[model samples]
Target: MGERLVADLIVERLQAWGVQRIFGYSGDGINTVLGALRRSGTPRFVQARHEENAAFMAVGHAKYTGEVGVVLSTQGPGAVHLLNGLYDAKLDSVPVVAIIGQQSRTVLGSAYMQEVDLLNLTRDVASSFRQQVNSPEQLPLVLDRAFKAALADRAPAVVIIPHDIQQAPAPELEQEHGVLTTAPVWSPPTLVPAPADLERAAALINDGGKVALLVGQGARGARGQVRELAEKIGAGITTSLMGKPYVDESHPLAAGVMGHLGTSASGFVLGECDTLVIIGSNDPWTEFYPPPGAARAVQIDIDAAAIGNRYPVEAAVTGDAAATLEALLPLLEPRPESAWRTSVEEAVQRWHRLAAERAATPARPVNPELAVRELSDRLPSNAQVAVDVGSIVYWYARQLRLPEGVPAHLSSTLASMGCSIPYGLAAKLADPARPVVALTGDGAMQMAGLSELITVSRLWPRWTDPRFVVLVLHNNELAEVTWEQREMEGDPRFDQSQALPDFSFARYAELLGLQGILVDDPAKIGAAWNAALDADRPVLIEVLADPDVPLLPPFPAGEEKGGTMMDALRKEGRDTQHARDLLETYLRQEEGLNRGL
Candidate 1:
């Protein structure tokens, strides 16, 4: 008999890659591999409630670890469930490996139970796809190629292991002893801006009365160069949400973010600048649409697909953001003394002051924005933040101040919900010593894989301390705020029928053996947050908030639903019958509480 079964060979390959853990849910088809893993005892198993959650957890792991996070699922629905997370990983440039099980080799085309064409289903999402491993002889090469494709492309890879093959006897193959390396090679591409292109960009900057730099996610690795360029040209900086951390917000040149949720400073700067130079950013909905229209735009990006995709550009320099910025810096002459820079700086200052006032106001029910700021204040200077999508995203992005060297993770392009928990887990797994927190909305958390909380409890017990805090801003309604916003726009019949039944997230956390705190009073928030962090365990703080409040600093003036709020207030006069009725409900509740006290 051959020394290795097909399953053992697969485990041997995985162990060589230095993979410490594989997040997965086992099924009959993949049980052979599980047994092999048990025997190897090198790469441990972290079981998840659902395969989707497994894939999501892997995404989180890769974000912090920068290693190839591994996920396993059975055939059919299991593999199907893994698709969303895989797509997320692909979009976010997180490296992951998904080991999926298929039906017996004999019944591959015969429609066996839990049998489906996973290869085709996952082709679009995964960076690399492979299947049909009949003998142990092919395992080493197939595995090697899959890892290369995944790490090199910085995307997800899927490997399908057929059931019959898993149990098959080994072939006469040489035992490879070396480790399987899967680290990405970040060599600078050969596409530098031409000398003429650099001169043109420099001339545009030097000649313009006022210039604004629009940075995006592609500027992530080029933060230093971005700051240097901004300083050299005395340029104002505004960023898309994905590019939030490109320039430190505290920097003198930082003008805040742009879009519907944009700050007043970014809008003001965009309106005043004669030239808008975009670097590594391509957010269509936010960056391009509400244009000042007259400003000349120049874009520099490594990906040719991004140029001319969102906003029209007079000059599109195809090169890396940092390198291009360096190339252009020397071509430009220093700006003569100009009031444009001073004027933009004043606008930014005014915006900052206004934001500070809003943050300082101690609302009775603790403003969500204030809550996020308080969280930022309490977190360690180097903590990693993973945020889920919703109204709260705007709140945190606007308020949370990331310290230098701290990396923040968010799914900006896809804007997927239910990502915070998994992302937080991945961050923690990648660096167990660093503090990792997931700021999530109440509705978003329900959609996330709650069972992964148990996985965190089991594997990284140290995180049980306040180190892992999942903050749930409990507004007690789904889609209600948007419906209310629409109702304000002259649609009295705007319905909030999508609101979910309120569930006790505090109880849910306790059930998972993690600390759970329900926060209703504004005064208790600080103490509760402090206690949670000090305890050093996994904690979930469910904040009860009034659902009627609008997500503030209203939408831009001419946006589609911009006038809806004002229209609703006008039609139903401030003291109209409906308003009186709602006020009566509030009065009754207030009186009831007073009497009880």
Candidate 2:
């Protein structure tokens, strides 16, 4: 501590940027930065069980808090382990900064241990900003730029600091020609489309009879504007998975999430609409959209490129969702409640009834739909939700009714398994007073959740409200993949790849000194949820769910996929009769709904 080192400078710069914590794991390569963090003792350091999970926690931090999440790791294998989570941030457009430690510069070409060309390895994921610090004088410049680029692009950025550079003496920038000083500073711009563009969009909306709005995560801040516009124009509102939390699903006109794992109401709205308004969303499921020329379209987005990316937009308003809607609202004339509006509401009501019926359907041990839907009413108003990828997401999207203002996030675009626990940890750490509930499937539990539970056990004692509840769908099947193979490839379930080894998730939580509740009886699902939500410590609720429940997409698309699933199941012979029966039951129900729609 004689004089501040470059590592100390790095810590000071992070504090200046308002970073309160760094998610990472320890290794010899990064010992210097670890020492600096220990000595300075400003930003807390969170150590995960592995480097991969550490990276996931950082991405989760960014997603939950809307801040530039910082993660540190030693180079080589540790850096390699970070790729998946870094890609999750890149795909979801979350801002994260990964600082990696490299081998000493003196051993540049000597093939030293734990030496990775991290700059090259991370180039794709951190294409927005990827830099390596070569000198102590370069640390500040690189660090500031990484944060700025991450904010500007809303993407992950990478900074690789060699061990020698990290331990080098901190340099002072002065009135020197070659030296530069930088501060951690950046802010979002107030962006709105031109008046003429807004007027054009308004005209299109006013002209259309059966209008539908497709909202995405970009419209998060414009919820009020979206509701007002929907009211003024008498339009139905549907959200992409990423936009689910932003729009109140409880709204009468709310059609729920749209796309493969979407609701029947959404399918009807998108299928039958004559006019579509794409608002701050470039949802990738183009097939679910209205057929080409089936609708007149208007698009609004901050990024000009995304305006026309999904659908054919006759009017493009390149601006922020809230601001653009404000300008466009005044030019619109309110449409009186009509048959189209009535139809939309009817569809939404029908979906609600259908969801409840589906949830109550009996299964082998428990119905996942029923298990997750139980949380709808039981969830606290101040709770935050994290859902892992798999069949569980379909249940979350279709059955769960999140309270207004409650935020639920998942690795949607990346569709990565094992993200829920990390995301839940980040959300809980951000606001310990609020309850956190994570919904994950058994496959994901084994992939990453098991190890992360240790992290949860270690941290729960420090939480003000120890109400972190994790609901695991313990079906002993890779249910999503099993269905995907049948639907996509028309292949029978290859038990080797589609089945999972069993593990006692609830008992494991008990071993870790946390509360554990196992529910196999469908009748006990609600009681289990109540106990876990009100528990004094972190709780893991393991539900013995049935894997036979179909992962069918919304109808029309579901029709073809259902046919493929039937063929595959038929090929499985009489041994798979139960699954075949379940599929047929769902298909019949969907066909009836389709006829009504």
Candidate 3:
């Protein structure tokens, strides 16, 4: 071990820290490090088709394993490509580390080929920690701090190693900073709200007859406690997009999803609540929460930084989600079930009936919602779903019937496309025993993830079971953005630029040594889904849906009962009668509602 190379030391340290895989493409600047990684041969490197996909894969790995996932790329363009995926981790507060290979210091400051300031390029997204190792002696301290900051801040970090420095002999390693690696299951120091803050929160819950629990991604570990708090207070539970799979939607108090992707039932509960309990989440979107001063609010979170940042806070109890709930549980009185809870329950039940009708009654171009619902029905109880942002989320956010405790991942904070596939791939890599599904639109698949299908081709033969399923809702348009352009701008011309060239995803899959299936007929969707789940390989099911089918959120954009198909069409300048005709046909087929047209 005497006089080891700096690159070799880094690989050894990462291995000691329990890193099993690295995702990236190797180039001249990074060759030395790759060689060192190969020499150690313990942590395997996953070669992705694109640097962006490599970044997304790292994020996926971090989220599923609850550890800092590592990604690497050579300098300049390779570094730039990591930005989008790195931003996802930063925005979502997921721990990830990106290592970039730099040109030799001998070429410093000449604007050399593929040589840009690594720290400067990555600073915005990797603000937690960004460092360049100038000397071989600087390697240990910089690497350790990068890992430390990534975990402690729950954000992405970056480290740059010049080509010349990486091959230099490592100095006597300094172990004085205690264990260099972060905890596998990192837990911040336990924080309890002051006695006065607790009393204030307790008073609000007791005084407000109708309480509503709004869960966020931050409130992940406290699902049971959140449920108890809701039930005890006779409140309904609603979740932000990231919190959608945290609580069982089947719970009587469940208001289903809230915020931009909110269900009508959840929206009603949020609007009607007298007091709101914000748990583990900053609740980033203003649209998701009640208007400021609309209701008294009690906020509980692990990071004090988020308290009162998004919404006005009457009681800010800073602590772990579950722990804070436990502390407050004794201080509050359980309110008996009120009309509020009954109303929420009634609304949810109505929604279920409506949803079932819609799923059964179908129309031409197929109801995307129905397709998703049917797919949801066939997926195993423990299936891990990675949902992309956009039209696909319209189905996944409202329709995908996720069982409680089933882990789900998404790029909610960044709200980016092309994340779902790599997210699923990362999840599958972490836990090969479970089935992982990536739900995306045709635009998203073509954007970033399509190339990574080749990555799957390279890795899938060794996989023991269903490595993953990429469910593409093939409408051949950026449906989510297209809807926004129409509704927000009142612009009906959703020109060619908004549309995608139709693709044969099944045929594309075949060329990659993977299973491919096309499901245009609704009758065969279930069978195709079953075959994919049963297959030992990764499968892509391209579901041909309609471009005209309006993809709407569960609730209205604002405070209205009009996320309905009619409303979407009306805004797009379709005549009232025509809108009604489309709606009636859809309702009749999906919901069996033929009462009027």
- The TM-score leader among the candidates is 2
Q: Write one digit per residue (lDDT tens) for candidate 2, span 1-597.
A: 477899999999999999999999998889999999999997999999888888888988998889998999998999999999999999999999999999999997788887778888998999999999998999999999999999989999999999999889999888688788888889888886888898888888889999999999999889999999888877999999998888888888999999999998999999999999998787888989999999999999988877788888999999999988888888998985978899999899888877887898889999899999999999999999999999999999999888878889999998999999998998888889999999999999999999999999999999999999999999999999999999999998889897899899999999999999999899999899889987899999999999999999988788879889999998874488888888888877777765674
* TM, every model: 0.85, 0.98, 0.92
Off by over 4 Å in 1: 127-137, 169-196, 286-293, 360-364, 460-466, 479-496, 552-560, 568-597
> lDDT by residue for model 1 over 196-264, one digit each (tens)?
777777777777778888898778878898887777777888888878866788887787777655666
Error of 1 at 498 (Å): 3.2
lDDT of 3 at 247: 84
Tell me the whole-model lDDT of each prediction, alpha carbons only.
0.72, 0.91, 0.79
Model 1 CA RMSD to the hidden true structure, in angstroms: 6.5
Worst 10 residues of 3 by lDDT: 588-597
Worst 10 residues of 2 by lDDT: 588-597
lDDT: the better of candidates 2 and 3? 2
After superposition, the stretches of candidate 2 with alpha carbons farther than 4 Å from their true spots are none
